[model samples]
Target: MGTLLSGRARAHPRELARFVRLFTVVRREIEYALRPTGDLLHRLALETEFSDFAFLQTVDTRFRQGEPLSDAWDAAVLALQTEKLLKTEEIALIQAFCSAFGSTDPAGQSANCAYFIDRLSELQKGAAEAAGKKSRLYLALGVLGGVFAVLILL
Candidate 1:
């Protein structure tokens, strides 16, 4: 059970790392290139190597279908949540980001992305540490269990 939880915990950091990278890209595109979000999303959908790249495509499609950008983003995040890809706190953070995104000037947009990137990075680090601790704890428990079984058998 601990091993299972450790594995699940490991995935949290990986997903957060992907989001950190994604938002970093957003910040760069908005701050340096001054590109509109639609183009950026389309490009990211095509170019991102992450397993969750489909969410970007989904957001792009939803946005093109006359939905608000935030709504489209929410739909995509909902998909992630449905897949158990994000925890509750992560989802809330993403929802907050969705609300703030594209609701301001280019500078503010860039700043928002940057801020989220930092936040996601911090979460990723914490998740990684948790996973490591869980892994070690589980390994120790498993060894102890095996020793107990061996003694009982003897």
Candidate 2:
């Protein structure tokens, strides 16, 4: 179980990086595509390498309903749960980034987007580093533990 979670933990940062890309895209598009958010969402959905494409469509619908972008993202947290690759901190960062669109000023929103992108990027980098260092260690430990257990039983 520890090994499984360790692997997933490493992978989770990449998932966070996906969200970072999404946030950066929105930041870049803020001037031309901020409003009529469905259009923005569609564009981002197509352009992004993110696998959770449905979440963007759902966010579009929420935007159409005039929900705040933050709330829309909050609504989509359920979708994140489905990915199974995200940690709670990652989810919280995404939730916090959802507010980037709350500002009417494109520059301000873009700044917010940049902040999220940077933060998520840093987080993903940290996770990737930990994964590279720890995954092998944990796998070895698990094998040794199993060997010890078998020897004790014998």
Number of the top-ranking candidate, with lDDT as the measure? 1
- Tens-digit per-residue lDDT, 52-136, candidate 1: 5666778888988989888899898889889786778887787788787777999899889988888888888988898888788
lDDT of 2 by residue, 50-148 (tens): 445666767767877998766777788878877767778777877776554654578788788788888889888898888877777777878888899
Worst 10 residues of 2 by lDDT: 45-54
Best by TM-score: 1
Model 1 has a clash total of 0
**Model 1 off-target regions past 4 Å?**
1-4, 51-54, 143-154
- How close is every model to the real structure, measured as TM-score? 0.81, 0.70
**What's the lDDT for residue 90 in model 2?**
76
Q: Distance (Å) between predicted and true CA of 65, model 2?
A: 7.4
TM-score of model 2 (CA atoms):
0.70
The count of residue-pair clashes in candidate 2 stands at 0
